[model samples]
Target chain A: MDTRERLISSTRELLWERGYTGTSPKAIQERADVGQGSMYHHFRGKSDLALAAISRSAREMRDSADAVFTDTGTVVDRITAYLRRDRDALKGCPVGRLTQDPDVMADPELRRPVEETFAWLTDRLAGLLADGRTNGELDPRLDPEATATALVAVLQGGYVLARAAGSADVHARAVHGALGLLTGDARRSPSGQENR
Target chain B: MDTRERLISSTRELLWERGYTGTSPKAIQERADVGQGSMYHHFRGKSDLALAAISRSAREMRDSADAVFTDTGTVVDRITAYLRRDRDALKGCPVGRLTQDPDVMADPELRRPVEETFAWLTDRLAGLLADGRTNGELDPRLDPEATATALVAVLQGGYVLARAAGSADVHARAVHGALGLLTGDARRSPSGQENR
Candidate 1:
């Protein structure tokens, strides 16, 4: 690969591992095996490199989701496919992780790619839900946009809970719960029932 | 406060701003206005200081949430109180933010406090949902533990989305959406169904 491409790829990986504030120019240079001068030549600094990396990551995320969002299937089928798609769950979402970085959040240019990626996901999911309603796969009363937002939040938030607990079980359980809600067969324990 | 307390507090603030990987002992010392020898005199090193900070942060977070969770009110009232509780929304959740730190995730010592905090939160929230189910305030079919996990995920994930977008609107909307689902009025949009 070219130097610029290697730099961008390295930045993406580092950003995922360390976030914007945690990642440094020297680390990027070392990871890319590029000299400081070369990195500066390609981009102004860490933020500039991060902007490129974030933009690239966002594009890749959108493209991957687009494949599922545009697939010919029921809305549940599509959403399930998207959710169940193989992922490095423990590593967390690359684009989603950027949101926690103060430096990234502070810079509009750095934050835009992350923002647009989620906006696209929510809008696409909403559109799919709209289709589901029209096809009688979902209750017409379901609000597509709001449900769409909740759907994405469930996945993203699941990761946080799982990571914090150092286990993927909570994340998987939450995903299952959300899917169950969507499918209308939500599970309940007797202990839970007694509260009602 | 004592020097040790000052150091822990300073470490907490720096950790929040720069994360585990980015925060340095020198920075902590500087922030605390303590000399290098003074810091090293009290703690072994950066990791030691970080553990203290994380543990303190965890306790603070639990105390903050406990105030809402333990309130004598209906389930919805408690959840809503926690949800609408005044917050530096853009700054994000202190304990929740650690989930994004690779360094913290890699170290069991650093990760334990984070794990305990979320685990406690889930258990606390699940109990409330259980109460709601028994009181007939929620659908009997809902899984309290699973729903509790989802509820926590919404808040964490909302911070991610909101921070990424540099706008709290999406976060607020997502929270409202989850509440609607929990309350069995999931069909309504943010505009109170007028948009539909």
Candidate 2:
């Protein structure tokens, strides 16, 4: 990667791993294998680089989610595909995790990507649920906005439960648990790996 | 307050406001009005003091939650009360916020209180829902464990959504959204602030 790409990529990883307050310019320079001169040449400072990184992370998150969202399948199947998609349960959601960083939330410039990403996520999920409600598969009266809010919260909150336990099973439990509720069917969503 | 009490209180406040890694020993000493020697005399170091602070926070969290859980009300009413209880929505959940601190999650000692607290919470909530199922107030076939998981996620995830948007409304939305699903009555839970 070039100096700019290296810096942005490194900043994205650092932000995911350590958050904005914990990540430092020195660490970024070290991780990116670039020096102060090159970093400054490409960006104004730490916050500037972070905006690029945060925006990149948000887009990456949404794009990955959108793939499953827009893919051909029953609405339940697509939503399930999105929730059950492989993720680093222990590491948590890169974009969703940013909400915990005081530095990020304290600055609107830094917070925009995070905010927009969720706005898009809720809207996208709401749209999908609305489609599901229109079909006979789900209860016709299911509130799309409320249900979508619950689904998004399940994923983010699942990360919290997983991290707190230092185990990934709780994360899966939360996901399948949500799938069960949304499906309005009590059958356990196949763990896909019950042995684990 | 005594030096020990002051130190614990200050650490809890800092943990709630800034998370584990963002808080420093010097900051703790300054906030607690205790010197480094006094700090060490009472505790080993940052990690030790943090354990005390985390445990205290967990106990306090449980005490407050237990009041609602054990209160006289229908199961849905109690759970709704727990979710809608006045909270520092933007500041986020004190115990739930710890899950986001990588430093807290990395150390088993530091992570235990958070894990135990959530474990207790999920179990506590499941019990309440199971009671509802028995009383025929809620759907008899509702999966208590899975439903409980979703409810807890809504609260933790609600905080994430609200913080990302820099507004408490989304948090309320997530809460009432879950309540509607849990109640299975499908009426919008009043935000109580329709005026806003």
Candidate 3:
């Protein structure tokens, strides 16, 4: 790969592994196998390189989500597919993890990709829910905007819980619960009793 | 406060504000106004003092959550109270945030409090939902453990989204969505339609 590409890829990996604050320019230079002169020639500094990397991560995140959202199936099925998709639970979401870094959140440029990724996810999910409602696949009373927001939160927060306990099972269980709720199976327990 | 107390308190604040990797022993000393010798006298080093601080934060997290959980109300009401409780949304959850720190999660000693905090929360919420089911206040088909896990995730994840967007409104919206689903308000769209 080219020096610029190598630098961006290295920065992305470091950002995911060490976060923005913990990652250093020297580390990026070493990882990319590019000297300081080359690194500076490609980008102004760490923040500039980080912004490029973050934007790339943001686009990739959306593209992957879109693959599921646009796949053939009912809206609920699509949402389920997205939630159940394979992931590196311990590593957490590349875009979502940036929110936890004080430096990333402190910079408007750095924070924008993270912000837009979520906004896009929410909007995309909301659209699917609206389609479901129109087709009588979802409850007519369901508020698309609110429910969409919640679903996104579930995926993002599942990482937090799973990481804390050092267990992937926690993440799976949380997703299972959210899916049950969305699919209406969670309306009643297995004992066959109805909710009032 | 005594030297030890000041040290722990300072460590807690720094951990919350700058996270584990970003925080330094020197910074902790400066913040607590304690000498290096006094700091070392109280604890082995940064990790030891951080453990104490993390444990304290974990306890405070539980105590605050318990206040709402144990309050006089129906199962749903209590859940709502917990979700709606006022918070500094952008700052994120103390224990939940630690899950993002590589150093903290790398060491089991440092990770215990964080793990225990989430475990306790999931259990407590599960207990409440089971009670609701028994009292016929909730749907009989609802899986308490799963639903409780989702609820905790929503709160944890809500902070993540909010911090990303730099707005408390996103967090509130996510909570509203989760509550609507739990309360059965999200079963349909606002036009008064029903799901198939």
Candidate 4:
């Protein structure tokens, strides 16, 4: 890749693996295999490079979600696809994970990508749900905005659960649970008992 | 508080605010107002102190959640209470946020409290939902395990969204959405129309 592309991509991976505090400019330089002079030539500072990386990651996250959001399928199918998509549960959601970093959250410039990405997801999901309800695919009683928001939350929250549990099954279970709710199978337990 | 107590509490705060990699022994010593010898007398190192602090924090999290789970109310009311409980959205959940820290997730000992905390929450919420289903307060078809998992996911995910948006409102909205689905209010949009 080119110098700027290499730097941005390296920054994204470093940020994902180590977060803003743990990720250093020197580390970025080393990872990208670009010298200090090249890094400065590409960006003003660590924060500037971080902003570029975060913005790119956020864009990628939205694009990936949008693929499912606009895919040709029933609303439930689309939502399920979005939720059940394969992921690196242990690593967590790249954009969603950034919200946990104090450095990223402290900077408006750094935080904007993360912010806009979620806003876009919530809005996109909301629109799809509205269409589903209008077409009688979803329960007429469903609140698109709320349910959409909940679905997005489920995916993000599932990562937290999976990471904490050190297993992807927990994350999958969480996703299945959310999909059940959206698909109107809310009353059926995976094990065939209500409480048990 | 005693020296040990002060040390534990300070470590907990640092872990919450700075995470494992970001928090240092010196920082903890300063925060707790204890000298090197005192810190060593209380605990072996940062990890040891963090374990004590994380365990304590996990217990407190469960206690706070239990208050809502057992409060006098209908099942939906209890669930809503659990979701609506006051919180510091920007800071995120003490245990849930740790999932984002590579150092914490890498160490099994350090990860135990976080894992147990989420596991306990899922089990507790599932039990409550099963009771709700049995009591005829909820739709009989709702899967307790899945629904419970969904609720927990929403809370964790809500924190992510809220932190990303730089506002608690998004988190609150996500909760309301989850509650709406649980309460069978899913069909209604906020303005009584779709796409508005």
- Model 3's CAPRI class is medium
Candidate 4: tens digits of C-alpha lDDT, residues A92-178: 888998888998898988998889999899999999989988898887888777788888899899889988988877777877777
Candidate whose TM-score is highest: 2
Interface RMSDs of the predictions, in order, are 1.4, 1.2, 1.4, 1.3
Model 1, span A77-130: residue lDDT tens: 999788666666567899999888877777888888888999989999889888
Residue A155 accuracy (lDDT) in model 4: 87
The candidate that wins on lDDT is 3
Superposed Cα deviation of residue A94, candidate 3 (Å): 0.6
TM-score, structure 1 vs. true: 0.89
How well does chain A score by TM in each candidate? Answer: 0.92, 0.96, 0.94, 0.93
How far off is residue A112 in model 3, in Å? 0.6
Q: On residues B140-171, what C-alpha lDDT tens digit does candidate 2 reach at each position? A: 66788878877888889988998998888888
User: What C-alpha RMSD separates each model from the true structure?
Assistant: 4.6, 1.7, 5.2, 3.9
TM-score-superior candidate, 1 or 2: 2
True contacts kept of each: 0.62, 0.61, 0.75, 0.84
Docking quality tier of candidate 4? medium
Q: For model 4, how does the per-residue alpha-carbon lDDT over B1-196 read when each residue is reduced to its tens digit? A: 9999999999989989988889999999999999999899879888899899999999999999998888898888888777877788777888898889998889999898899999899999999988988999887887888788878999999999988988877777788788777777754443321111
Candidate 1, clashing residue pairs? Answer: A195-B133, A195-B134, A195-B135, A196-B133, A196-B134, A196-B135
TM-score-superior candidate, 1 or 3: 3
Question: Which digits, one per residue and each the tens of the lDDT, describe model 3 over residues A1-196?
Answer: 9999999999999999989999999999999999999999989999999999999999999999999999999888899889878888788999998998999999998999999999999999999999998999877878898889888999899899989978877777777778777777884332211110
